[model samples]
Target: MTALLLIDIQSGLQETVYYGTERSNPQAEENCHKILEVFRNKDLPVFHVMHNSTNPASPLYPGKKGNAFHPLVQPIDEEPIFQKTVNSAFIGTNLEIAMISRNITHLVIVGLTIEHCISTSVRMAANLGFHVTLISDATAAFDKIGYDGIRYSAEVIHQTELANLKDEFAQIQDTVTFLTELDN
Candidate 1:
């Protein structure tokens, strides 16, 4: 069966001040909701990966409201929620064992900050033999600074990271393509 893997789509990412910069794809959460609706309507398997940052001062600290899942994509009781401190959902979590146990072979991935958890999870999913379809429009990225003090725009960071993951780690699809496939 195919599963929807939502990585770190938490309230903290909505706080621009917390990230120290604006994020690309302001509509990302909306797109994620749309895809999530499709998955629910089809009764597909869904997994929510929550990032509980180990940094005490980070917005995503376990007790903070920022660590909570965004309301729009919140999981229903039947959906499983996995918590992890690392970038990959599989690391430090039972996600891989759960997927293997359930015989889930294909994954539809979406979430915040493409350069971080999203990138790591996609690569690991592919390496673990799951067919991954990453919804580009449903994922966003924050601006980044290089070691030399050069700044990269959120769009550049988002696109470059997607480029890096394409073909090797995942098959990139936009929200529209993903929805269309679901409909058919």
Candidate 2:
């Protein structure tokens, strides 16, 4: 069975000041919502992963509202949620066990920043033997400042992560193509 794994689509990610001033893929959340809608309508399994940052100043701190799921992809009552503090959803969470128990071998992934939780989870999922399809348009990335003082644009970080994961970790697809394939 296939499942949608949405990682950290939380309100905290919207605060660019916390992550970066420039964020790539302004339509990422909208694309994520589109995929979520289709997944729900089709009665497919959907798993939500929330991040509770240990950093007190972080927007995703446990007591902060930013830790809440974004309104766009809020989970319904029956949908299971796995909250974690780490980058990979598989660690410190039963997400892998749950999917394994459900016989879910294929994963359709979408979520917040591509270079962080998204990349980590994708690689880990592949390493664990699940077939993964990461939706390119349904994920975003923040601009990063290199240790050498070079600044990388958000688009570069996003595309690089996708390129790194493509074929090796996951089959990367855009929202429209993924949705079309899902319908077919």
Candidate 3:
């Protein structure tokens, strides 16, 4: 089965933690919606991965409004959501078991923090031998400090991830191609 992994589209993370310059995706919400629409139209499984922040005050922390699923990325009644603390979605989660049970192979991933959760999960998925397709435009990130001690722009981090990730763990594709392929 082909599944869409909507990784960490939580309100707290976007609105509270990574606000301002970080939420600067050209069409942030819409990009996610487009990906969601493709999965919905294709009648494919959409798995939502949410990060459970340990702090109650943290956006990703439990009991916080920001820790909840963002309104724009709301799931249908039948969809499944996995709450996790680790950057890798498969860790301590039933995600792998669920996918295995369903015989799911191809995974379409989209969501926040391309430099973190998305990157980690994609690599993990690839290492586990899952065919992964990362939505370049659908995933967003924030300006972050790199190992080089330099502040990197969101686009810079995103592009770097894309460039380095290709053929390493998963194949990176543009959102337009993902959507276009859905039309066929």
Candidate 4:
């Protein structure tokens, strides 16, 4: 069965400066919330991945308020939440085992900073033989400085990651497209 994996939709990501100077897809959280609602309503399996930074000063540190999941996509009691300290949600967490135990063959991924945790998790999920569809619009990206000191915009990074992952790692779909799939 298909499952929804909301990866790292944490409050710390809202503090854009903490990640990068600029970020793309500001509506990603809301889109994630929309997808979450649909999964809950349909009684589909839903899993939440939370990033808990080991760095004490980081906003996602365990003791910080910013470590919490964003209000928009907060998990209900029944939804299992997997906490991770690394880029791929499967690493250092029981996420893969949980999905496997439940016989979840497909994963729909959405969440913050597409270039980081989202990308890594998508790639890992695909490698582990899960049918993966990444909600492109529901995952954002931050600007990065190239080796030559050129600054790339968040949109460029976002698009590049999506393109790199397309076909090779996972199928890419926008929030609207995923919602349409649910309807039919």
* Per-model CA lDDT versus the true structure: 0.93, 0.95, 0.82, 0.93
Candidate 4 lDDT, 60-156, residue by residue in tens:
9998999999999989999999999999999999989999999999999999878999999999999999999999999999899999999999999
Give the Cα error of residue 68 in candidate 3, in Å.
Answer: 1.4
TM-scores, one per candidate: 0.98, 0.99, 0.91, 0.98
* Candidate 4 CA-lDDT value: 0.93
Which stretch of 10 consecutive residues in model 2 shows the poorest summed lDDT? 12-21
- Please provide, for model 1 over 97-125, each residue's C-alpha lDDT reduced to its tens digit, 9 standing for 90 to 100: 99999999999999987999999999999
lDDT digits (tens) for residues 67-157 of candidate 2 = 9999999999989999999999999999999999999999999998799999999999999999999999999999999999999999999
The per-residue C-alpha lDDT of model 1 at residue 90 equals 96
Tell me each candidate's RMSD, in Å, in order: 0.8, 0.6, 1.9, 0.8
User: Which prediction has the highest lDDT against the true structure?
Assistant: 2
* Two-way TM-score contest, 1 vs 2, winner: 2
Q: What lDDT does candidate 2 reach at residue 72?
A: 96
In candidate 1 the C-alpha lDDT for residue 102 amounts to 92
Pairs clashing within candidate 3: 12-66, 53-60
